[model samples]
Target: MDFSTMIGHDTIKNQIVNSIKGNRFSHALIVTGENGIGKSLIAKEIAIRLLGKAEEKQYVDIVEFKMSKDKKSIGIDEIKSIIQETTKKPYEGDRKVIILYKADGMTEAAQNAFLKTIEEPPRGIFIILLCEKLENILDTIKSRCQVYKLNRLSEEEMLKFLNNKFESLSEDELKAVSAFSDGIPGRAERFLEDKSLMEIRDTVIDILKGICEGKLDKTLLYTEFLLKYRGEWQEVLTYFLSYIRDTLIYKETGNKELIINIDKINEIKDIAEMFSFNKLNGIINIIKDTRSKLERNVNATLVFDSMLVKIQEV
Candidate 1:
């Protein structure tokens, strides 16, 4: 995809294009943003641009390295492999590009091992590191790179892009998908085809409702059901976060205009009233932290159980 195809982060795109055009591109570049905010897309675009387009059955010589979720870090061996690849001459383009997705997941040792290459990067090689957290990286490493921060897209921009791209969708379809996308274009795309996500979201909302009504045991049934989809815990938490955010909005504004869960406004109101603002905030923090830890490979059942027990106290 071209840089223009990216939904947001215009400033970053322009900066990168200017850098490439001026032959002043940084050897080390870090792209940081929240999940669903197009960091990976940007990284891929930059890589393709650097590598240039390739013909059929021809190798463009671009290397992509993703941090392993199971390992919770980029291994030293992988870094060594990247270094070896970087040492080679470009196969098809003027420069060889290496895109590292989830560089923040790199272990301390891996980061240290990578520093040598960063300090004296190979000629004609451009390295792009994509991450969500900048603090997780060493300061010396960050100092050697140009760091670009990506923010969430505005609702107007998000809606416009969705309407333009999904022209055949109904108004309700657009609204529903837009709300669930939460101002992220990549997420909006996923929401378009994800028929099962709404059902899972409904289940989460039902669990929250049961808790608010003092039917705490009902969460156990939902929790069991959630575990059945082992790989979907992240998606489940994302929906849960959106559900709580909608409830909080309804509570604060008392305006249906801002409510996304229109069909379940009553339930949102009930939960919003049952918990104090501080309690709700704390629960949200807990969910966010639990979700992060879950991404780092914490057991799903254990995480959900702990979250349930903690939320019950509120």
Candidate 2:
């Protein structure tokens, strides 16, 4: 896709365009952002521009390196193959672009091996490393590349993007998507494509409403529901946190517009009336703590149980 069509990151796009125009584009570039933040899309756009090709046509000169689905880390052997490939001249254009997806997944050894090529890249070779974590890249490797970080879009920007992509969504749906996407375009797309995610979101909202209504006996039942979607526990927690945040916002501002879960305004109002600001804040804190614990590989069952109990107590 054209950079103009991409949502947000106008500054970075302009810089890239200017750099290409000036014929002073860096041989190695690093693109960093959280998952679903459009790092890959940006990298691909750069490749298309660099190769001077139409977006619909595949260019032989553009090479992408991605971690295998079965592999947790990109090993040294893969880097070696890429290094060998770099020795060959571009097949279809004057410039060859190597786009490494999830470059942070490269092991230290693989990074060190890959570093050799970027340190002294072949003529007309451009290396774009897409990473979620900048710290995972070697300092030496980072020093040799120009780093561009992608930040989350504003709510307004996200809403515009959603409107452009999905015309059928209602105003409330747009607002919910903008808030749920957390300003990430790719995430917003996922929400549009994955109906199951919407189901999970609804379930989480129901669970929160139950909690707000003092359904203590249903705590275990809620935990069981969460466990059923263990693979998506993070998403479940994010949904929980978001609704609680909306409740808190409503409680404090008394403005329906400020709430993210706009479709559930009535439930949010009920929640706001049922709890004080301190209690709402306490629940938010508890959700954050539970998320932290889950990230640490804590027992999911215990964490969920404890989180429900803590919320009830609050």
Candidate 3:
């Protein structure tokens, strides 16, 4: 895919294009961001463009590796095999591109094994490390590469994309999609993939309604329902947060256009009026903190329980 096809991060795309155009390509580069933010897509696009080919198969010089699903980490042997592969000359071009997906999944030993090769990369060797977390990678590995921390798309950008993709989408649908996207284009696109996602969002709104309205029994039941789908806690948390955020925005600004959950304007209005402005911040923080913990692989039940208790305080 070309850079134009990839939504968001126009600045980063231009920077990469310019660097390659000027022949100032770095031997190693790190593309770090949350999943669904298009890091891997951008990396492949960069590799293809830099290799002077639009077709992936035509770029014989490019090699890619994803984290081995059979193991907890990328073993030292895997890294060594890649290092060995990098030693060979390009088959069709002067430059050989090494695309390592989820590079942070590399074991400590694998990272050490990779140090020498990345430190003094051979002629025509270009390495791209795509990772979700910068902290998981070693400083030695990080220092040797140009690090690009990608950001999410803006509300306008996301809305524009949704509008372009679904011509018949209503204003409320557009608003919900744009707001729930959390700046990730892929997350926004998932609305098109999964039909039940919006249903889940509506249920989350019901749980919030129960809690905010002091309907403890219903809220407790809703919480149980939420935990039943514990596997989707991440998606649940996202919609929950987005709904609350939209309500907060409406409460604070009194601007309907600024809110994301347009279809649930009545619900948002009712919920927003139930609490004062100060209470909203605390609730937002509680949910945001819970999301961070969940992202770090904490126990889902414990995190959700803790989050509910804290939110109840508001």
Candidate 4:
């Protein structure tokens, strides 16, 4: 894809383009952002430019490293293989681009082993590390690379991007997508393409409506319904959190424009009326705590049950 098609992060893109034009691009670069925020796209663009490719496709000189399907973390063996690969010259171009996805998943030993290669990379080798969590990357590795962070786009930017990509969608649908994506272009794309995600989002909204209407007796049913999406429970929680956040914002400011979920304004107003600020704050805290527990690999069944009960109480 053309770099111009990208939605945000213009400054970083400009800098990289200028560096490539000047032939002064760094040997090692790190791009950090939340998941689906276009880190990989940026890396791909850089690789294409560096390799003098006219289109976005797999180039013989562009290499990628990522976790195996069965692996939880990238281990030292993989890093060793990458180190060996860097020794070879580019297959089709003057330069070789090595892109590492989920680089933060590299274990300490793996990072230390990879550090040796970064410290003294072969001539004409460019390394790009794509990471979601900057804190997980070792300081030594970060210090040796030029790091760029990608931030979420504004609503206006997101609308422009969606309009460019999905011309079939109506204005209301576009606005809803902008709200649902929370300024992430990749997420907006997913919401448009993934029907199951839309179902999950709708279910979350329904459950919140029930909660606002004081349907405490359906707490168990809600938990059971959520449990069915255990693999995507985090996303479910995110949807829940987003709706509640919008409700809280509307309640506090009484400004419809200031809230996300704009397409659900009536529902948000109803939810806002059903709960006080303290109650909404309590529910938000509960959702956050539930997410933390899930991330820690706590028992999913128990976590959902407890979370539902707590939210009902709130």
- What is the model-wide C-alpha lDDT for candidate 4? 0.88
> Per-residue error at 199 for model 4, in Å?
1.8
Collision pairs in model 1: none
Q: Name the candidate, 2 or 3, with the larger TM-score value.
A: 2
Please count the clashing residue pairs in each candidate, in the order shown: 0, 0, 0, 0
**On residues 1-314, what C-alpha lDDT tens digit does candidate 3 reach at each position?**
57876668899999999999999978999999988888988888888887888675546687898876767688798898889988999988788899998899998889999999998888989999999889999999999999999998888878777777777888887777776777887887886678777678878888778788776555666667777778777888778777778888898898998877777889999989986777778888888898789779998777877777777776
Q: Can you give the TM-score per candidate against the true fold?
A: 0.80, 0.92, 0.85, 0.90
Model 4 TM-score (2 dp): 0.90
Of the pair 1 and 4, which is ahead by lDDT? 4
Q: Residue-wise lDDT of candidate 1 within 1-314, one digit each (tens)? A: 56766667888899998887787879889999878788977877777666655222224576788766567678789888888888888876568888888899888888899998887788888888889898998998899888999988888888888877889987666776788787778778876667677678788888787777666676666678778765778778877787788878887888987777677778888888887788788779888988887879988888888887677666
How does each model score on lDDT?
0.80, 0.88, 0.83, 0.88
Write model 2 residue lDDT over 149-193, tens digit each, in one string. Answer: 999999888988998989999988898888889988988888889
**So what's the TM-score on candidate 2?**
0.92
User: What's model 3's overall lDDT?
Assistant: 0.83
**CA displacement after TM-score superposition, residue 165 of candidate 4 (Å):** 0.4
Write down the worst ten-residue block by lDDT for model 3.
215-224
Error of 1 at 275 (Å): 8.1
Q: In model 1, which range of ten residues has the least summed lDDT?
A: 51-60
